[model samples]
Target: MSENLKKDYQLCEEIGRGKFGTVFRCFSLVSGDDFACKSIDKRLLTDSLDRECLEKEAKIMQLVTGNPNIVQIFDVYEDDSYLHLVIELCNSSDLFDRISKRTFSESEATAVMLPLMEAIAHCHILGVAHRDIKPDNVLFNEWNLLKLADFGSADWFLGGKSMSGIFGTPYYVAPEVISGRDYNEKVDVWSSGVILYMMLAGIPPFYGESAGEIFEAVIRGNLRFPTRIFDSVSPAAKDLLRKMLCKDVSKRFSAEQVLSMSNSCLILIVLFKVEN
Candidate 1:
């Protein structure tokens, strides 16, 4: 840990752990405010590409700092051994954990998704693509507000340019990404669509026993709504899902377009209403 970080904040319990770092619930020495401190071990980031991605993630988070739906990064500290990022602390569970606890109705899912879409729109508008958009990356604050976190796979694609390389979770990864084709921010839309499908039906649109199988299914890009599971789902919700999950990248709905539909009262109303 950095000496400067310890001097500034009191690191508390371990809240999260990943490949490169562990997240701690920290309290600021000056203000006594709670925050999450992600302390990354510099030794683990021996690869130049890994270091570059880490730098990019910080820059991207800083770029989208004002977005309400995205988690805010407050401070950064570095020493010879560790790099610490002090970010807004989210006391509640992640989206994956919350959804696992109970099923969501259309209105409830819509409520959760609107803010998430807004977050994605904000990132896209800033020319940043959050290559990873799985439910685990979506968190909730103490007030139960949604916050999009983890930009490890994020990168810039300014001016609508395409990005290459495959960087996303298997189940939520876009087809273009799996195929090794140059893709754009629209990949986030596809991942969001997968999340919506999972939320509404209580299952993923595609599945398999192994990562390879899941990747194949994602590449095939066949979206199906089984009658038994989706019988209660509204047509408007399904329509939006189809648009977001469209295999044809050229025809897929952009984050802004989805926000536009959400902004329209008719679509919003239709999406929120439960079918008889």
Candidate 2:
């Protein structure tokens, strides 16, 4: 632990753990404000790529800090052995845990998705792409407001340029990414679409016994809505999914377009008092 970090905050019990490090509940000594300190073990970053990713995560978090749905990073501290990130504390369960607990109504799913897409749009507008956007990275605060966290796989994609990398979770990765093609920020939109599909259908649109199988299914890009599972899902919702999950990058809807369609439905819901 860094001496400066210890002097500035009081680290409490561990709150979460991941492949790279542990997150702890911490309190500021000066203001008594609560925060999460993600302490990354430097020893585990065994290669140059791992070190670059750590730095990029911190930079991207800071770059998108002001968005309402993106988690905030308050401070960064580095010592010889560990790197610490003081981030906004979110006490509620992650989206994955919440989804596993119960089924969601279309309205409920819409509510969750609106803020999430907003966050993605914000990132894209700022020239950043959140390559990894699975449910595990979606957090909630005490008030149940959604927050997009963990930008470990985020990168810049400015001026409509394509980015080349295989960076994303299997279940939600874009088809272009699976094919090893140069992709842009639209990849995040595809991942968000998968999240929406999971929310409504109670499962991912593409699946397999292993990551390789999942990638094959993704690359094949055969999007379907099983009648039994999607019988109750609204047509407008399905239309949005089709646009978002389109394999052809040129045909896929951007984050802003998805938000526009969603907002339009929300307007109709208000006028006609519809459930969808």
Candidate 3:
């Protein structure tokens, strides 16, 4: 977000808050659009590295603003207490919120994925990887496009920290991330794989009694597609899921490859895998 980009919105009620700052609803005077303003406190961000990571996210948002699939960062500003971020206000909540209510069909999966893939595709081309990509981080706009948000953990290949922790949601953790291996863009593929698996299966690929058990299973690369759950799913959809969740990053499907599977690819990515 560019400070030079003028801030023309008046802040409304708070919508979200995190470690760094709070998010509020606002109305944009220039575009006449509703937007969310994220206010980050520079004082709370003590670590220089972490602060730089936030800065990098803002910078990337500048490039991805025009992308249809991405959450648009309308403007950025700083005052005495905090840095204000005016981003596109997604009317709908996150995928997790939806999962808590109704069941979804395969066609619905395609609708959600179209924009998700487009935004992610943009990030990959720019060499930026969203380290955290679970259901909660994925928001929905009025059109039901999955607006990828919460870029707090997002980092580029050349900068940011040595990402070695168990970063993402336990259910979505990729093998490489669990192993503490120096990973790359492929980590996003692994997360998307988990999302796709849940979308089609109504549950994650692996299950355990505890977080330790889940991490152990992930670290071991244990994967199983039960015929009982997937009995109704198409072969092409299953094939696409297999490609996204492939343990080896070298062979996993790219966002483009997964999107190509489209109508047939629709059923397997999100409707079944997520558990509220």
Candidate 4:
């Protein structure tokens, strides 16, 4: 006997907080399931716009439900003055934590990226954009798979039109976004490049003292990879980075093109070549 929604789900502990929400690890009283509840205050949103963001989060999550790389948003319920997102509790810490410890092995990167690329590529096919694609937004350990979480900043690329109101984290944003130009799927590619760079080198290519500086660096293509830092990786890895970090939206790689090479059936192919 599981109560759907009313009081608390499982009562684990407060995990983290962002500008707009708090994350909790809770176990379901019903069916004994575990879940993560992100309780976001409607008032905390940057604009009075979160009503739409919350609704969009719920709706987009429903579309993203069955994805192996997406956190399953179970329900969005509101009582007197609260909005709760009941999501499948993705157990592992974020990819950022992993990088903080050690660089990902080639196979490890492949395992992580494969399903994630599938999910994002599918999302694009479905006409959605996961505007935020930072390592902090990735969760693993639920069946040892990378589950893309936090669609709070998502935007639907609806009806073949470009929508405005800037979205995405600063470092992961595409150059076009930084320049305030009309952009699309290429934004996702840029973020994916940053993610892959982090995976291989244990940090994002763009570094800066301030947010604005980071935006400038990304837009100016001011990132440089030390041959020493990338010593173990391959030239193809650099090629991938070049394609993803292009300043021109028209010059960036598409997810389809990125996924097709596999270079050895594993796209992004990692920095190391482990035999044939």
Top model by lDDT, which number?
Answer: 2
Q: lDDT per residue, candidate 1, 111-150, as tens digits?
A: 8888999999998888999999999999999999999999
lDDT of 1 at 81: 82
> Which residue segments of model 4 deviate by more than 4 Å?
1-4, 7-10, 263-276
Error of 1 at 208 (Å): 0.8
lDDT, candidate 3, 69-175, per-residue tens:
77888677876667787898887878877755654566665576666777777887777778788878788788776688877777776553345545677878788
Full-model lDDT, candidate 1:
0.89
| Residue pair clashes in candidate 4 | 2-30, 10-27, 69-148, 233-271
Ordered by TM-score, highest first, the candidates read: 2, 1, 4, 3
Measured with C-alpha atoms, the lDDT of residue 63 in candidate 2 is 92
How do all models score by TM-score? 0.95, 0.96, 0.84, 0.89
Of candidates 4 and 1, the better by TM-score: 1
**Model 1 error, position 93 (Å):** 1.3
Candidate 2 at residue 3, lDDT? Answer: 95
What tens-digit string does per-residue lDDT give for candidate 2 at 1-276? 899999999999999998889999999999999999999998899978778889888889999999999999999999888999999999999999977877677788889989999999999999999999999999999999999998888998888788987889999999999888898899999999999899888888999999999999999989999999988777778889999999988999999999999987665545543553
Give the C-alpha miss distance for residue 178 in model 1, angstroms: 0.5
CA lDDT scores, all candidates in order: 0.89, 0.91, 0.74, 0.76
> Model 4 misses residue 141 by how many Å?
2.9
